[model samples]
Target chain A: MCGIVGLHLRDPALYPRLGELLTGMLCEMSERGADSAGVAVYGDPVWSPPGHATVTVIGAVPDLPDVTVISLGETHVVHAPVPVDALVAAIRAQLPDALIAGFGEELTVLKGVGHPRELAATFGLAKAQGWQGVGHTRMATESAVTPEGAHPYAVGPDQCLVHNGSFANHATIRRHLTARGVVFDSENDTEVGARYVASALADGRDIESALKSLCAEFDGFYTLLVSNRDSFAVVRDAIACKPAVIAETDAWVAMASEYRALVGLPGIEQARIYEPEPERIYAWTR
Target chain B: MDSMTIVMDKGVNRTLHRLDAGSVTITEPNGKHSVAVGLNAPLQVSIEGHCGYYAAGMNQLADVVINGNAGVGVAENMMSGSVRVNGNASQSAGATAHGGLLVITGDAAARCGISMKGVDIVVGGSIGHMSAFMAQAGRLVVRGDAGEALGDSIYEARLYVRGKVASLGADCIAKDMRDEHHAELRSLLAKAGYDDDPADYTRYGSARQLYHFHAGNEY
Candidate 1:
């Protein structure tokens, strides 16, 4: 079992409170999954500065003086003044073995092994400002209990995906994707799900069609929360064994594995709360 | 009547652990998972807000009510007692429940009452596709429309639908509405706070075909 929480702010005024609210939501899910926690914050200016590309590399890295480096434990964020391709080349040349979990123009994915509350604090999430954030607390069913196995597996540009249950045909799909030259970072089943969405979006499929394709191809239980630069979406499998709830207000759209993760949001009582229908795509845009 | 109220925050164990016996009122439920599970004492639990998965799983001798929407598995494997969802319920609303009265005031999503053994489920609104799949024994009453593939692979369990049925599952055939069924459905509707005439409903059950799979049987 794992816990996934996401918040997409429709009002610009609520951006500053994104991290604080998300931290509470993640911490509340500590009991559901205690092994590790991860989060992807969108539109964090310092982490993903305007016009610059950002890369999230797992583990410590030798500082490249030209880029702005922010270290949170072993996780490192390199915000380069140049485009994303240039940053990718520099990282490949400097630290070839460093696992780049995600690189994007508007997202910064940070993760670590510990209680979600402490990880949120260590990553400076409370101070981070973003229009959207997605977090996960993983119990490590499909893969090892490593930080890389933890979720908010942001594989594609400005894309983030977190999952709560196991995928049955992930290995088969993984082999299929690998044959097609999609390099993977971890053995986690959720990583396969993220790669599938990334590949779908890369192929020019819209969010709804990509999610529908996921329902057609994958098997087993899953409740997925996916976020991109301008959209937030959620979808469940046919069985929908995993739990997910969504609450939408004029200011924001929030989703969590359970209701407790959502209760802390401001004006929650006024929000239109409901569970996403199984095999149905619920997507919202900025 | 005197009632004990427990305020639940993020912790689920603590909230359920406190309900030893008697009437209980739970406020600020905040969608915690597995609330009020395995309760043997006769009691009534009123959750003031939304709830998460398995809100009253494996319950016994208790009536649990949710004021807002419920996540998946609202009353999974319930042995006895009743669960009332004031708002909508997600998939598997009464999955594998053995004995219970589960009432959903709002719609129930896909696979509601899946694998139900002996529970009685009544939905105020529509139920999604493939509901009551592989149900062994129970009674499902849908006041509103039922989605595609209702009561697939159904066993002795009886299904009653007031609105249109999108389709019936394998071996599940619509039967004539009998007088005895109307009396039973009327009692269930009354228990679920509905006074609709049971005569307006249709009855469905397993055809006893495909009980034992022959070679090349189409599932």
Candidate 2:
């Protein structure tokens, strides 16, 4: 089992407290998964500065000649005044063995193999300021408990996906994608799901359509929260064995594996809270 | 009878267990799992806020109420007594329960009474897909609509739905609502504090087609 939490702000007044709110939500779900944790922050000025592309590498890349590198615990954030594709290519060429955790124009992904609360402190997540954030705590059902196996798989440009349930037909789908030349980063089943959604989004389908395609092709129990620079979407499988609760107020929209993670949000008492129905896509946009 | 308030923390269930008879109010539940499970004595318990998984599991001779929403398996494997949820319930609300009356005033997610041996579940709002899958015995009554594949592979347990049924599951067929079935539905609804008419309901039960294996039904 795993835990997934995400926050999308509708009121700009709450932007400064994004990380603080998300940290509480993430830590409350520590009991769901304690093996590893990962988080993705969107529109953070310090983490993803304007007009500068960012690529997060999992391990130490001692020699990346001409880029600003910021080390946060186990992951390294590399910033350069170039396009996202160019920076990713450069990092891949220089550090052949380095794993590119995330890459986007307005996103920063940090991951580690440890307790979520400790990792949140190490990453200074409470001090982060952003418009959107997504976090995951994994119990390692499909892959090993390594930094590379953590979730919030940011495959496409500025897109991130986190899952709470395992995929039953991921191996078959992975072979299908592999036959079509889609390279994978890890053996984790969630990565396969992320890659599939990323490919669908690349083909110009909207987030809702992409997730619908995923539900059609993939067979499993899953509650997915996929986000990009502008949109946040949540979807569950047909059976919907995995639980998800969504609470929305005029100021923000939040989702988690359980309602406890959302009790700390502002105006929670008055918020419209409900569980997302099976096979339905609930999406919010900036 | 003594009345006291207890803030939920570690050993809260044990504290509730120690009480032989009293009215206890649980505050700040904060979605904690197994809040008042395994009760053997007659007690009146009320949870003021939302609860996590299995709030009153294995309850017997206790009347527990949740003022807010309940997470998965609210009263799983209950042997006796009553549990009520004022708000919605997640999946498997009364799974594998042998005896009791579980009431949900709001919608219940998937698998409302899975494998229920002999319990009575009444939902005020809709229920999600695959509810009452393989239910052995008991009665499940829904005031609102039922989702896809309701009562799949069901056994002796009777189902009464007042609203639209998206579809029926395999081996679960609609039966004529006899006078006795109507009386049973009315009693169950009254027990759940609903005024809905039993005449507006439909009954469903197992077809007994899959009870024994046959080569003709093989895939």
Best candidate, lDDT-wise? Answer: 2
True contacts kept of each: 0.81, 0.56
Best by TM-score: 2
lDDT of 1 by residue, B1-219 (tens): 458777875554464556656677888777767777777667788888887778888888888888888888899999999999999998889999999899999999889989999999999999988999998999999999998899999999999999999899999999998789989999999999999999899999999886787778676
Q: Which number leads on DockQ? A: 2
Instruction: List residue ranges in candidate 1 displaced over 4 A.
Output: B9-22, B77-80, B212-219
TM-score of chain B of each: 0.93, 0.97
Measured with C-alpha atoms, the lDDT of residue A66 in candidate 2 is: 79
Candidate 2, residue A90: CA error in Å?
2.1
- What TM-score describes the B chain of model 2? 0.97
TM value for model 1: 0.91
Worst 10 residues of 1 chain A by lDDT: A237-246
**Per-residue accuracy of model 2 over A1-286 as CA lDDT, tens digit each:** 8999999999999999999999999999999999999999998888788999999998877967878888898788898889999999999989989899899999999988999999999999999999999999988888999987998899899999999999999999999999989999899999999999998888899999999899999998899999998999999999899989999999999999998899899999888889999999999999
